[model samples]
Target: MAATACRRGRLTLPAFLIALALAPVVGGRADTSFDTGPELGQRLLRDVVRIEARDLAEHGFGLVVGVDRDDVYIATARHVVARRAPAGLVEPERASHAIAVSFCALPGAPRQLAAMLDGFDGADDDLALLRAPRPSAYVPELKALAPAGKDGVGDQVWQLGRESDCVVVPTPGVIAGRPDTRHTVRVDLHGALGGASGGPLVSGYGIVGLVKRSDNEVIRAHAIAALAARVRALAGPPFLLGEAGNIPPGDPQAAVADLTETLNGYLFAARDLNTLLRQEIVPRPTFAQMVQRYNGSVNRFKAARDKYDGTLQRNWPAGTLPQWQALRERLWRIHLRFFGLNGQSTTTITGTERAPPPVREQMAALEPELAGLQSDIARFAEHLGKRSIDHAELSQ
Candidate 1:
């Protein structure tokens, strides 16, 4: 069903292909009469987040619906947080599991934070709330959409979702019908995909429902109006649109420390890629083993690049330090050589059945760049008086 395809805890080949095909295609805008233009869509993204369970392979999208003076509350599908139990009861695993809530849309905000389960309304409601303390630096001013009163059939609506890559986007649709049982309202959105479940269904009026599941044509969502009280109780007081929580001044030393850590992580991944190019490829290992190792290296490189880019976006120590700027430029050049465009890895081997000659040649070509990057990173670490963080540490 659409639920499995859309709420991706882990990316499968089929889901990745589907996401590749449709993720770039943006849906039409909502009616301009209600001021639901590009500006509003961009603003809504500030409150949306991609949720991941730390203990389990469960991932989905959610909304920061309530931000009190001290904390922020996130709402998502219960299935995203807990596994289903027998006799329609929800599992208690959520209470013990640490969840990661990430704000991908808001720039310069803490990219991810640890959240804990705040409340749940069981299988019937299919709704869950999570709470995380507001950060000491820059809290996102959230505009929580209030539950709309009595949404009728044929009303225009929008469902917000995260693509497999965790880019928040909106799918426009309309309310088709209200199912009498289970407090679900069906939506006629055609673009809902995996990694989109647990997103909000909003209309010109307000938040109409929370996404439950979807088939080919219709999407079933838990009506927010029916459980509005529970939501309020769980999320605490509603979020004010303009409320700016306490934002402390930036700490340059702390930022530099974080930047150094992120750089180390990136360099670590880069060194691994370099080793794969040398030890795995040049040795002419079996095709299967080569493919497997190449795939693993691609994943590591992508993750490292994502983290490095995200951290720099939040706080780039290179902006003020000339030496750091030079190091950053070198890193970017290496990153571009490995990841040419659209974030696709140059050394990726898509199908294991056959390792194309062109791919093999490309892998061979990347060796020099990878080796040079490792050397440059090591020298940069040494220049910063941190010999322990050199490329030699990759051995440990």
Candidate 2:
């Protein structure tokens, strides 16, 4: 990335340029599975800024990924501006002046900003973190770090960069594979250069990784999900690690689909089981028939819980993970109680027959829990429905 108190012109980094050090993707057909242009693109452009020099000597790019009360954190490749960085600089080298920034939001205008080295996984990884000024007047759409392991092979994604001449270019890539030697991703892409260092590789869900380097055959990125846990513990609060609205539903519609399927199953099973006792049957079924119905309902409930647990774990906010665990344990308790009711040896009861106090009380308590669970689930389903990637963005 570039340095400060200088004129706004081209940002030149080491010969490593982006290619010089950690510039920033490669191949595959464009994936329309998630949208990233115009709106989200504009927001990112404002953040994926051009790093300039005080004397107008160097240039490269950095992304504005996070912010706190005072500063905004810029994520770029260490090689791009690492030499000019004075904080962790090796001796004998002159301390470089502060860096200048050319933000896409304020085109043609560059501002002087101190680019301080915050934290970097040197020797082990190619990532670098820089702290910049974030005054009240400045605001860009902040993107959050996606949870690690959420991305899988075949997941479609997009890349953004400021390679040259101040244009923020978008490239499409797919998660092809991961290298065995290092914690780098092998993406099918090309065409990255000096100016493109430190760009972001975004999935439909949100910011998944940052560019490590690009080559003639493959584009590589240092996946951030795993590093996120470490980054959160860094010194500054400016690294607002996991903010909402930053990582929206990568595919909202798909998220809602599973929830609705299992939710409807739950609604039907609960209604049938509860109504079994309420209605007066012309010919009440035997105890075995009632037990079968109860068992079937219980099985359906357990399956639904598993399905729902899968969805919430993936899409729910990190803060809500514990809440989901609680819900899951509660669901298990409900299942166990119902299973016990089915196993009652002493009382053989038909649909219209009332059960013993203990069995009835436990089952009756489930009424309120089930009702509350359904309402909450409905709300969650609706939220997921509305939270999908914009239709236009995901379109081919």
* TM-score of every model versus the real structure: 0.45, 0.49
lDDT value for model 2: 0.53
* Model 1 local distance difference test score: 0.53
Q: How accurate locally is residue 383 in candidate 2, as Cα lDDT from 0 to 100? A: 55
RMSD from true fold, candidate 2: 21.1
lDDT of each: 0.53, 0.53
Instruction: Report the error of model 2 at residue 182, Å.
Output: 3.7
Model 1 quality (TM-score): 0.45
Q: Report lDDT (Cα) of residue 83, candidate 2.
A: 53
Q: Which stretches of candidate 1 lie over 4 Å from their true place?
A: 1-34, 37-39, 86-96, 108-111, 118-120, 137-150, 165-171, 179-181, 234-396
Model 1: which residue pairs collide? 5-194, 6-193, 6-194, 6-195, 7-195
